[model samples]
Structures are given as structure tokens and as C-alpha cells.
Target chain A: MLIATALASVFIRDLFAVIMVFGIYSLLSAGFFLNLNAPDVALTEAAIGAGIAPILMLGTLALTRKKWDPEPHAKKSTHTPLLPLIVVAITGAALVYATFDMPYYGDAEAPSHTHVAPRYIQESGQEIDIPNMVTSVLASYRGFDTLGEVFVIFTAGIGVLALLGFLSDGSGRKYWQFADTASLRRHTVLHVIAKILIPLILLYAFYVQFHGDYSPGGGFQAGVIFATAFILYTMISGLQAVYKIIKPELIYWTMAFGVMLYGVTGLVAMFMGGDYLDYNALDHHDPIHGQHMGILLVELGVGICVAAVMMSVFFNFAGRGIRLPEDTKEGGQ
Target chain B: MSVVLGLFNYWIVIALMMTGFYLVIATSNLIKKIIGLNIFQTSVFILYISIAKVKGGAAPILEEGTELYANPLPHVLILTAIVVGIATTALGLALIVRIKEAYGSIEEDDIREKGGTT
Candidate 1:
């Protein structure tokens, strides 16, 4: 089923249908992850693959709608298929050939099974005292990689801001025209449902935020759901309504702050006479408790940064006022 | 037959990956390329996960008296990878929008015809 969706996306010339099919492709992959016993990954994949990717794509479509002709005749491919087909076939064959010597799926005696994974599985309980090994590995053990991941997200946010200019469309003028309250007031059903659901989603985000050590969620999932709640709010009430409630400056600073918080946590550990990002030295007297402190702060940092980035990206994509044909040249006319 | 059956998951994953590869290079549309990149990304993910599975193991969340558990390492890496993928895709889509604004078209040849290299 997942492969079918992907193939459909590849064959479907219409961008809108491709994006929708891509969403289902992601959702099915999430199900596949669950079947393989990677719930931590499954949670993040579902949130991202189905929820945020489509929203951003749709927003891009809305802005670029004026550029593309809707007529089917405009969808013809200009590239020849022969070279690309040969390349793809060769790559696929090489990949499959490489897998021949690999241990069959799920074999207990496989190289990976005998390596560091078992150590993380067996000793983490004693060392980190955390029930969720993925969280401990992510937020505590391999802290540097997660830090890099956070910065990647932060960098993307900055890139988008430079390109699209979030709050005023990178210029000083009012970007959106219809931020008027009538947009939300016109749809009472949407308003009522969102009013009831947004708070609950926010509350659940907090649960995932704080309970990551014991469960399948951590900052990434929590931050995604948190930002998603705001995205939902924006969708229902319009981007202007969200800006009214949550200052755009606050969101921008929060993105920077989340990354900083992660850095500060590592620096504080360094100041305490331990290596950078060594959470064991966070509370030297009680190392487990120190691990707890480190993981919580880092996860909080991740959550805060991710939530801010997601919301800002959505706003930048959705906030571009209406794109007009005259707005095309070197500068906005 | 059993040899093929035993390794079917890996083979199927390869086929899925090439589907993405074909879309990316065979098509001229910018959005389709992004979607192809996404499909290619998922194949790698499914690769990591299927390799991590243990026949009798439970999910990586530690529970009392649960002896066997799937590998937690790949799960950790893929978790971050998934988010980074979205971040990069967002960046790609943003660039595509900018291209549309500047070139007035998203087709690669069309952009190139207008003297803007895709």
C-alpha cells in the first residue's frame, strides 16, 4: 500500500494529488515503523510526514498558484527517460547486491545486534535510569547529534526568514489584507471545534514534553504537536489572529533561545568541571539525577526550538499576503 | 524461493528507492523532484527500521521483566533524521517558491529557457 502511494505520487503529474498521496505514503511508513517496533521514530514520522509537510507544500502551492497553468497540457515532461532509468537501475542493483552479505532481517546474531545497541539496551537502565532508551540515547547519550539536529532546524528557520520574511513579508508594509476578524467569525463550526481541540492538543504536547523519559515521545514529537496546535489555530482564525495572540518577535526569539538553551546546558556542564554535554557531571553527587536534569533541559530546549521553527515556517509560507503578477521582478512593486 | 523470500524486504526497499530516483531525474517539474526526494528519504528509513527488528523483541521502551527488545540505536538516529528531513524539505520548498517568483515558472527547462539555471 505504501509503495503504491509512492508510485502514484511519482506518476501523478498534478502537484496537488502528489502532495496528498505523499501524505498517505508517510502515514503508511509510520505504520511500517510501528510494525518493526520503532515507536519513537513512528511518532515523529507520522507528525512530520502527514501533518507538517503537506501544510507547507499546500502553502507554497497557494503562493505559486498564479504561476502554473491548471491545464493538463502544461504538465508535459521535457527530460528524456533513458539516462535516468539506466542510472536508477544501476544504483538499485548495487544496493541490492550490497545487502546479500548482510544478516537476514531481525537475526539476533547479526553484527548490529552484537554491537553497541545491546549495551545501550542493557546498561542504560543502570546508567541513565530511564525507561525509554531512545530518549536517553537521544537527549543524554548522543547529545551532540541531537544538538546538531536542533541547529539544522534553526538554520532552516533562518533561511526561510531571509527568503520569505515571516512577519511583514521581509518588508515594512502590511503583507496580508484580510487578517480581519470576519475570517474566523464566518466559520463558527471551525471556530468552536478548534477552540475545544487546540487546548487539549497543547495540554497533550506538555505531557509528551515532560514524560519523554518514560515513553515513546521526546522534544521532537512534543514540539511538533505543540507547533501543530498553533498551525491549527492559524488555519482556523487566520495568520493575523495568531500574531495578535502570540507576538511574532516572541516566536522568532524563541527559536534562537531553544538552541541557546541546549548550548547553555552543555556549557554549564563544562563549567561544572566535566566534558561538554556530559550530563553525568550536571549533578555530580547524584549522577542519575544529573542525567535527569540534562535530559530534561536539553529536551525542553529541543521542544521549544522545534515548536517555534514549525510555527514560523508555517507563518512565513502562509503570511506572504496575496502574490500578484506585478510582484514578480527584482523587488516587490 | 526461500532465499528470495528471506531477503524480500531489502529487495522491495531497493525497488521503492528507484521509483524515487526515477521521478527525480526523469521529470522536469520542481515540485515532483521534491516529492521524489521525499520518497527516496523514506526508503532509507524503512531500511534502518526493518534491519532493527527482532523477531520476539518488544518496543524499545523498557518494561519490567521484558527480556527481549528491538535495537534502539537506529530508532534514535532515524528520529532525528525524520525531523531534519522535514526541515530540509521546507527549505527546498521555500527555494522552489523563490524560483517561481523569479523565473515565473517551476519547470526546469522553462526556468533554463528564461536564462535562470535550475
Candidate 2:
């Protein structure tokens, strides 16, 4: 059934059908995660994978024409995808072969288990008081990666905003009026849900932010969840409502603030006579305690940036309709 | 027999992953490509879950006097991946909608034609 669904997703010509199949594929993948004993991961996959991605894709579909009408002249390249396909297959085959050499399923003796993971699992509780090893790994031990990921999201937001001309003053102002008021009123279900969930989601985000030393949640998940709530609001209540809540200037400023928070935290550590981002130097406290404090602050920065970036991207995309180019004579004037 | 079952499942999932990836990279249709991406991602999820299963082990949830339980880490990792996948898809679809409006068709070739650039 999974294989069939996958094939159908690829071969199907209808854009809408293809998007729906992709959603099914994500749903099935979520089921697979449940089988693996990762409820946290399963929840994220189900919510983001099967639920949000498809909706966003569908919304894009609505903006564009439904039928895929390729020009006949463009059909001349019959063998275009062949070379790339072959290269991909070879790489995949190599990957599979490499996997065979990996430790067998659930082997407690696997190298990964023997390596830093065991140390993380054994020491993190004593050091950081976090029961969730992944959270500890993500927030403290490998906090730099999370910072980079946050920057990636921030860059993506800026890219999208620039692409849609939302960076310019006139274009940005005009774009705010993109979503029709009728559509905004029609999606009352999402509006009500967002109204109810946004605060809870923000609260949970803070909990995840601070509770990282003890639980399965952390900055990344919390950030994404918080962003989702805001995205939901924008989707239902429209760009105008979102603008009321978070103006375009605030979005840009918050994004910068997030990055600066992370940077200054590191800089402060440097000023305190330790290396960059050395949380252990925050005070005269134990290195581990300093690390804990640094991780918390950094994760908060990450969460803030990610949430802001995601909202900015959604607004930039959704707000595009209002800014029909002046030269095109289609500005809906 | 059990080993064979495991190997077979792995092979099938890998094959499905390849096919999905091929379609995604090969197809000019934006929607079809997203479908292919979904298939590819789902295959990875399968690979992770399959690795988590212990042949005779019970579910990972601990209970009174239950000693054998499958691993839980992979499931957690896959869950995170799924959320990331969904976010990417949502953003991609939203992009597609904007693409359609700007260029007038979801077909890659047509959009390129309208824009006069690939």
C-alpha cells in the first residue's frame, strides 16, 4: 500500500491529487514513526507533515491555474531526467550497501550507543538535569547546529520577502491587503482554533524553552509549534489580522533581535574570558551550570528567530496578491 | 526466515524511495515533484521504523514484568523529520500557488515559458 501510494504520488498528473497523495505519504510516515516508539516525533510528523505542508501546497495551487498545460515545443527533451535518475540510483545503492555495515537493528553494542550518546545519556542528567537526551544534544552539546538552522530559516524568510517585493516600502504596504476579506471570514474554523490555540501554543513554547532540561520538548519543536499557530491565524484571519498582531516592521526587527541575542550571548562569553559561546564563563559558577544557562538563552534566541521567520514567510507569500506590479496594469485599481 | 523478511522489507522500501526520488527530480510538474519528495521522505521514515523493531520484542512502553521492548529513539527522530517535512511541503505548496498566479500554470515547462526563463 505504501509503495502504491508513493508511485501514485509521482505519476499522477493532477496537481491537487498529487498534493493529496503527498499528504497520505506523510500520514503513513507518521504511522511508521509511531511504530518506532517516538510519540513526540510522531506528533510533529502528523501535524507538520500530513497536515500543514499539504494545506500550504493546496493554497499555492489555488493561487495558480489548476491544469498543467506544457507547451508542445518544451516536450522535445525526452531523455532529460535520465542522467540525473541514474546518478541518484547509484548513490542510493551505495547508501544501502553502507547501511548493511551499520550495527544491526536495536544493537545496544552499536558504535553510536557506545560513543558520545551514552555519555550524553549518563552525564546529561547529572549535568543538565534533562531526561530527554535528544533535547540535551540539540540545545547544549550541539547548540551551534541549532543556531545555524535558525539562521537558515531567517534567510529563507528574507529571501521570500525580497522575492515578493515585500522588502520595499510601497510593495510591502500594498501586499498587506492581499488576502480577500470574504475568504478571511469564511475560514471561521481555523480562526476559532487559532484564537484558542495561539496562547496555549505560546505557553507551551515557553515551557518547552525552559523545561528542556527535563523533558522531550525543546526550542526547535516549540518554535515550530508557535509558528504554526501564527501561520494558522494568518491563514484563517488573513494578512490584515496578522499585520495587526505583528506588523511587518516588528517581524523584521524581531528576526534581527533573535540573531543578535544569540550573537551577544556568545560575545558576552568571549568578554568573560572564555571562547565564543562559552556558557561556562557566564559567571564564576561551575562550567556545567554555565553551559546550562547558555543553552537556555541560546535556545530562546533560536525559538524567537524561527517563529518570526516562519510568520514572515507566510505573510510575504499570502500578501503577494495585493501587490500586482504597477507596470502590468493588473494592480486591481 | 526472519532475516529474509527483514531484508526483503528493507529492499522494497529502498526501491520505493528510489522511485519517488526519481520522479521528483525527473518530473517538470511542480506538484509531481512534491509528490516524489513525499515518497522519498516516507521511505526514510520506513527505514528508521524498520530498524527500531526487534524481532520478538514487544512495544517500547514498559509495563509490569515486560522485559522485551523495541527501541524508541528512531521513532522520535522520524517524528521530528516528519514535522520538518510537513513544514517544507507547506512552504513549497505555498510557493507553487504563488508561482501559478505569477506565471499562470503549475506545469514547470509552461511556467518557464511564460517567465521566459527556466
Candidate 3:
């Protein structure tokens, strides 16, 4: 099913259909993760891949659908598929051949299972005092890598900002106006439903954020869900209401501040006479308490940065105007 | 038959990866290319998760008397990777939007044929 949807999405030219198929592919893959006992990964995939990806793609589609409908020029299909097919065939064959040496699916003696994992499973409760070993590994043992991940998100947000100018900039405001509508005047049901559901989703995001030490969600998933709540509200209500509530400048500040917060937590730990990102140093009484404090703070930082970045990217993409082929003189509206 | 039974899932993963690779290279549409990239990334994610599975293991939540558990390292790694993937996709789509604005058309042939900015 996943492969079918992926192939269908690739083969289909209608951007909307492609986006929906892509969502289906994500959903199916998320289910596969559940089957594989990786619920945290599955939740993140479902939220970002299925929920947010389609929205962003739809926003892009709205901008470009005009040019797509008329197919631009009838003679613009002079591309060859033979080369790609040959290259992909060789790569696929090599990958398949290589997998023969991999430990059979679900083998207990698999190298991945034998090394590092058992220690994480056995010691995490004693060391980090967290039920979720993935969380302990993510926020404690591999904290530096996670920090880099947060910054990568920040950089991507900045790249999007540089490409699609922020709402504060006068240049992209016109595009926002084009995408914006006054309200959900026709469907009061949608408005009411959104009003009720948005708050619950935001609340759930917070629960996921704080409870990640025990469950399948963490800062990344929580942050995406938090951003999704706002994105949903923006979708149901107009952009105007959301902008008025959060303000564009606040997003930039929160994004930078989130990264700063993560860095500062590490510095605080260092100043406390421990290595960088050493959560044990965060608390003098109990190293486990320090780990708890460190993980909580860092996860909050990640959540803040992720939420801000997702919202910023969505706003920028949605705010940008679609460039029409007829308007050859000037760029997008 | 033994090999197929043992490594069938990995083969499926390769098929998905190759399909994505084909779309990314063969397609001229920028959106399709991004979708292809996503499919490819997802296949890789599946590969990693598949590697972490234990024959009769529970999810890696430390609880009482749980003898077998899936590998947590891959989950940790892939968690970050999934976020990175979406970040890349978002950035790619944003670039495509800019490309559409600047080049007037998103199709590669059209962009080249018109002899506009590459």
C-alpha cells in the first residue's frame, strides 16, 4: 500500500491528487512503524508527514495550480526516463544484494540489538530515571546530536524566510492577502469544531511535551502538533486572526531563543562542573534529578524551536503569492 | 525460498527506494521530485526501523519483567531523521515556490526552453 501510493503520487500530475497520495503513503508508513514497535517515530511521521506535509504541499499547490492547469506549453514534455531507470535499477539491485548479509528480521542476535541497546534499556532507568529509553538516549546520551538537529531546523526556517520573505516584509503581504479569507462564514460547524478541537490539540501537544519521558511523544512531535493547532486555526479562521494573536516578530524571537535555551542549558551544566550537555550536573542533590531537569529543559527548547520553525515556514509558504504565466512582466502577485 | 522468507521486507524496502529514485530523476516537475525525495527518505526510515525489530520483542519502554525489547537506538536516530526529512521537504518546497516565481514555469524543460534564469 505504501509503495502503491508513493508510485501513484509520483506518476500523477495533478498536484492535489499527488499531495493526497503522499499523505496516504505517510499514513501507511506510520502504521509500519507501529508494527515495528517504534511508536515515537510513528507519531512524528504521522504528524509531520501526513498532517503538516499535505498542508504545506496544498499551500504550494494553490500558488502554482494556475500555471499547472493550462499545462503551460503543449510541447514542454521532452524529458527521457531511460537514464533514471537504469541508474535506479543498479542502485536497487546493489541495495537488495547487500541486505542478504543483514540479520534476519526480528533476530535477537542482531548486532543492533546486541550492542549499546541493552545497556540503554538496563541502565536508563537507573541513570536517567526515564521510562522511555528513546527519550533518555535522545535527550541525554545523544544530546549533542539532538542540538544539531534543532539548529538544522532553525537553519531551514531561516532559509525559508530568506526565500519567502516574512509577513513583516511588505513584499509578501500581498500574497498573504490573496490566500486569506475573512472567516468561515459558510460553515459555522467547521468554525465551532475548530474552536473546540484546536484547544484540545494544543493541550494534547503540551501533554505530549511534558510527558515525553514516559511516552511515545517528545519535543519534536509536540512542537509539530502545537504548530499544527495554529495552522489548523489559520486554515479555518483567516490568517489575520492568527497573526494578530501570535505576531510574526514573536516567531523569529522564539525560534532563536529556543536554540539559545538549549545551548544555555548545556552551558549551565558545564558551569556546574560537568561536561557539556551533562544533565547530571544540572542538579547537585541527585544526578538523576539533574538528568530530569536537563531533559525537560532541552525538550522544551526543542519544542519551542520546532513549533516556531514549522509555523514560520507554513506562514511564509502560504503568504507567498502564486506567479501566473500571463503576468510575464512582474513576478508573483 | 529461504532467502525470500528471510529478507523479503528488505527487498520491498529497496523497491520503494528505487521507485522514489526513479521519480526524482525521471520527473521534470519540481513538486514530484520533492515527493520522490520524501518517498526515498521514508524507505530509508523503514529500513532502519526494520533493523531494530526483535523477533518477539516489545516496544522499548522500560517496564517490569520485559525480557525482550526492540532496539531503541534506531528509534532515537530515526526520530531526529524524520524531523530533518520534513525540514528538508519544507525547504525544498519553499525553493520550488521561489523557482516558480522567478522562472514563471516549474517544468525543467520549460525553464530551459525559455532560456530564462536557471
Candidate 4:
């Protein structure tokens, strides 16, 4: 079913069908992760694949709205397919050949299973003092990698901001003129349902944020969920209503603040004479308590940055698609 | 033959990966290319996950009487990767929105002809 949807999405020329099929493919992959016993990953995949990815794609479709013309354009530049085909075939063959040496699916003796993993499972209770080994590994053992991931998200947000600009930027007003807001307002069912559902989603996001130490979720998933709630609100209420509530400038500040919080936590540890990202330095009297505090603060930093970045991205995209009536009243020449 | 049977899941993922790779290269539409990229990425994810499984293992949560558990490392790594993937996809789509605005069409040939590069 996954392969079928993926193939359908690729071959389909109609952008709407392609996006829908992609959403199905994402949901199916989430199911696949569940089967693999990776609930945390499965949850992220479902949220990202089913929830956020489609919303973003639909937003793009709205902006573009280029009909799929079956008839090829007269000036369609000639593209050679032979080279790309050969490249793909060779790459595929090499990847398959390499897999022959890899341990068979579910083999306990696999190198990945034998190394570091066993220790994490066995020692995490004492070292990280967390029930969820994945959280312990993510927030503590490989904390540095997660730090890099947060910055990568931040960089992407910065890139989008530079391209799309803020919602209130005067220079973007011309593009905003073409934005179609009346269509978004037509769905009252969605509006009413969203009004009921958005608060619950925000509450759940906070649960996932703090409960991550004992469960399958953490700051990353929590942030995405929080951002999704806002994206939903923006979809139904129109970006204008959201703008009145939360300024675009506040989102930018929050985005920077999240990353800075993560960095400063590490610096505080160093000043306390522990290595960077060492949570133990946060509370010298009780090292375990310090680890707890550090993880909480770090995850809080991650959640804040991720939620802000995702919100800003959605706002930037949504802002690109809608024109305020006031803009016409003021700028229509 | 038995070894081949044991590893059949890996082979299927490889096939899926190739299909995605083909679509990415063969498709002319920019959005379709992103879809293809997503398929290719998810296939790699399946590969990581399939290898993470231990035949009799349980999910990696600390509890009494659970001896064998799936490797938590891949789960953690892939969780981060999934977030990064969505971020990348968001950026790509944003670029597509801008491309359509500037080039007036997201078709590769149209963009290539208009701007001499896609």
C-alpha cells in the first residue's frame, strides 16, 4: 500500500492528488514504524507525515494553483532521460549489494544492537535516571547531536524568514494583495471544531513536553504538536485573526530565545565546572537532581525553539497567501 | 536460500528506495520531485528500523521483567531525522511557492526556459 501510494503520488500530474497520496504514504509509514516497535518514531511520523506535511503542501498548492496541462507546452525544453535513469539504476544496485553484508532483520547479534545500545538500556536507570531510554539517550548521552538538530531547524526558519519576510513587512504587501481569504472563511464547520479542539491540542502539547522523561514523547514531538495547533487555528480563523493575537515579531524573538536558552544552559554547566551540556553542574548538591533539571531545561529549550520555528514557518506561508481588506483600503493604487 | 528468505524485508526496502530514486530523477514537476525525495527518505528510515529490531524484543521502556528490547539508538536518531526532514520539506515547499511566483510555472522545463536554470 505504501509503495502504491508513493508511485501514485509520483506519477500523478494533478498537484492535489499528489499531495493527498503523499499524506496517505506518510500515514502508512507511521503504521510501519508502529509495527517495528518504535512508538516514539511512529508518533512523530504520524504527526509530521499525516498532520503537518499535508498542511504545508496544501498551502503551496493554494499559492501556485497551476493546473496540470496534459498537453505539453510548445517551448518545453528537451530533457534527456537516459543519464538520470542510468544514475538511479547504478545507485540502487550498489545500495542493494551493500545490504547483503548487513545483519538480517531482527538479529540480536547485529553491531548496532551489541554496541552502546545495551549499555543505554542497562545503565540509563542509574546514569540518566529516566524511564524512557530514548529520552535519556537523546537528551543526555547524545545531547550534542540534539543541540545541532535544534540549530538546523533554526537555520531553516531563518532561511524561510529571509525568503518570505514577516507578515507585516511593507514590501510584501503587493504579494499579499493576491491572497484569497474569503475561501478560508467559508468552512464554518472547521472554524467551530477548531475553536473547540485547539485548546485541548495545546494542553496535550505541554503534556508531551514534560511527560517525555517517562513516555515516548519529548520536546521535538511536543513542539510539532504545538505548532500544528496554531497552524490549524490559522487555517480556520484566517491569518489576520492570528496576527492580532500573536505578532510575527514575537515569534522571531521566541525562535531566537529557544536556541539561546539551550546554549545558555550549556554555558551555565561550564561555569559550574562541568563540561558543556553537562546537567550535573546545574545542581552540585544532588547530581541526579541536576541531571533532571538540565534535561527539563534543555527539552524546554528544544520545545520552545521548535514550536516557534514551526509557527513562524506556517505564518510566513499563510501570510503569503492572504490579503487583509485594510491593505487594499490603504495600498490599492 | 534460507539466508535470502531471512533478509527479504531488507530487499523490499531496497526496491522501494530505488522506485523513489527513479521518480525523483524522472519527474519534471518540482513538487513531484519532493514527493519522490520523501519516498526515498522514508525507505532509508525503514532500513534503519528493520535493523533495530531484535527478534523477541520489546519497545525500549524501562520496566521489570522485560529482558530484550529493540535498540533505542535508531529510534532516537530517526526521531531527530524526521523533524529535520519536515523542516527540509517546509523549506523546499516555500522555495516552490516563490519559484511559482517568479517563474509563473513550477514545471522544470518552464523554469529552465524562463530563467536558464531550474
Minimum summed lDDT over a 10-residue window in model 3 chain A is located at: A322-331
At residue B114, give the lDDT of candidate 3: 73
Give me the runs in candidate 1 sitting further than 4 Å from their true place. Answer: A67-77, A166-185, A321-333, B116-118
Which residues of candidate 3, in runs, are more than 4 Å off? A67-73, A166-185, A322-333, B116-118
* Per-residue alpha-carbon lDDT of candidate 2 for residues A155-272, written as tens digits (9 for 90 to 100): 6666666655353445435466454542666766766876798789778877866775565455556666787777777767767877787788898888888877887888988999
TM-score against native, each model: 0.94, 0.79, 0.94, 0.92
Write down the lDDT of every candidate, Cα atoms only. Answer: 0.87, 0.65, 0.86, 0.84
Worst 10 residues of 1 chain B by lDDT: B109-118
**All DockQ scores:** 0.80, 0.34, 0.80, 0.70
* Clashing residue pairs for model 3: A106-B55
Predicted candidate 1 versus true structure: per-residue lDDT over B51-98, tens digit per residue: 889889999989999989999988988999999899889889889888
- Which ranges of candidate 2 are over 4 A from the true structure? A1-4, A66-100, A165-174, A177-179, A182-194, A323-333, B5-9, B41-103, B111-118
What's the CA error at residue A287 for candidate 2, in Å?
A: 3.6
The CAPRI classification for model 1 reads as: medium
Chain B TM-score, candidate 4?
0.94
Residue pairs clashing in model 1 are none
TM-score of chain A of 2: 0.82
| DockQ of candidate 4 relative to the true structure | 0.70
